[model samples]
Target: MTAPRLKVFSGNSNRPLAEEICQHIGMPLGEATVTSFPDGESFVKINENVRGHDVYIIQPTCTPTNQSLMELLIMIDAAKRASAHRITAVMPFYGYARQDRKDQPRVPITAKLVANLLVAAGANRILTMDLHSQQIQGFFDIPVDHLFASPVFFKYLEQFKGDNMVVVSPDVGGMKMAAAYAGILGAQLGMVWKKRTNATTVETVNVVGDVAGKDVLLVDDITETAGTLANAAKIMRDSGALSVRAAVSHALLSPIAYERLALGHIDELITTNSVPVDTRGLPIKVLSIASLMADAIVRINNNESVTSLFKIKGF
Candidate 1:
């Protein structure tokens, strides 16, 4: 079968990651002019012809959330108008995913809203990693290829598999992810009881499971303020845990998170480079997911099954 002509372009958000992905796929990054007007308007122009091509726009809705999202939408619209055969939005880190539901009386589901925006902007499909809620995929009218960061984290964590390790969820909600980590690493499972004091604060109540004298690894989909991980680490340490570390998929570190990580309660933070993260001299190890994403892109372009990529250590 003849392969579809594939072209990949990137927005201003996390250009380094897109470049890495291009390198992994053995292709040069597509030519594009993405800039800002003096009035703060985003300007995007595809310098190369994308007519009838399977186009993928690499843009992560990272720190400057609104700008990145706007850039992606504009890029998608540009591709659609330029007569691309298929347009896929490659979002390594999806912002506004936390507002997936309405727990409050009158709140908007930004995740769904973003999904609508993507569809309206002419995205035929989406590729993202480790969403805040898995259900967010259901909101999209277009096909969403949700990728997990576990495969990348697993290889980096294999060295500590034989240690007396306990994979813990920093909060009640993250139990499922922790359980998966525990099952894959062949470690004990644990959970931390916590209450959200505020948006940026988390108060840990207690720790469950046996963590005494064992190395604790907290697992979560995302960490912005680091309150949950830091507080959980403190409680685990107080409960006689030998060491406390955290393995988070997306670490959107805020100023508060930087301060918390500097406290040293958590010995190390293992995370993926879904978004651009600055270590800032902290003990942060950012594992790259570029190769994994590149492979997935190739599979998607080839119309191949991505099931094998989802498997983790025979689990």
Candidate 2:
């Protein structure tokens, strides 16, 4: 008995990351034609046969969220129609994730809707990283391999390990994530209490833990307008912290984010290449998760557990 062949394809969302993943996996990316018509309809045509093969489509629903999402669904449907044995939607940065719940009346749970759309489009499983909320995994009935970028961040953040370091969550909601980093780095934990003034503005009110004279490292799952992070950093700086930095999983930086980042509240911003991020000459460090994702893909194909991938040395 032989294992089914594994094939990886990518949409236009994050092609560079996909190419890097294929390079790490030592396989060529499966060819596909993903384009738009003049009428603005998404079209996907798999150039290679995937019959009885294990297929994975890499498409992060970022920037042009709707278009990227539609392309992924079409690609999945094409692979399903081609008789693929299994299909996995590889979304490095799951967009619409922040809308997992309805905080207001008459608001829809777009995260759940996206999950249903993927499953309806013939996705057998999902492989994604650093979702905005863990509960989003429950939105799907299919198997979900949720990988974290912590291990990668841990390796890069090793240099900052010291008694003077304090890990802080930009908001109360990210306290859990901040605690994990603090524990692994053997540092103190802290949090910022922030109120969302609007979709793109935030007001940081209070600090939960001590940051005085400590090198503060703020952690979060995502940042769009940079409001939460910037405000948190301002409060941390005003609180007598020696320095303030940030480690975010996804940097969906917008023009406003760039403007905020330019204010120089945070010293350094470390994040992953989960989505397309342009530094625009800011103090930002982008790490690659290609090897991390490629290893998971190979393990999944071989029916092996990916538990070890999450293990960080000295943690």
Per-model tally of clashing residue pairs: 0, 0
lDDT per residue, candidate 1, 63-128, as tens digits? Answer: 799999999999999999999999999999999999999999999999899999999999999999
Q: Estimate, for each residue in 122-161, the C-alpha lDDT of model 2 and write its tens digit.
A: 9999999999999999999999999999999999999999
After superposing candidate 1 on the true structure, give the runs of residues whose Cα lies further than 4 Å from its correct spot.
Answer: 313-315
Candidate 1 all-Cα RMSD: 1.1
Off by over 4 Å in 2: none
lDDT of each: 0.93, 0.95
lDDT of 1: 0.93
Model 1 TM-score is: 0.98
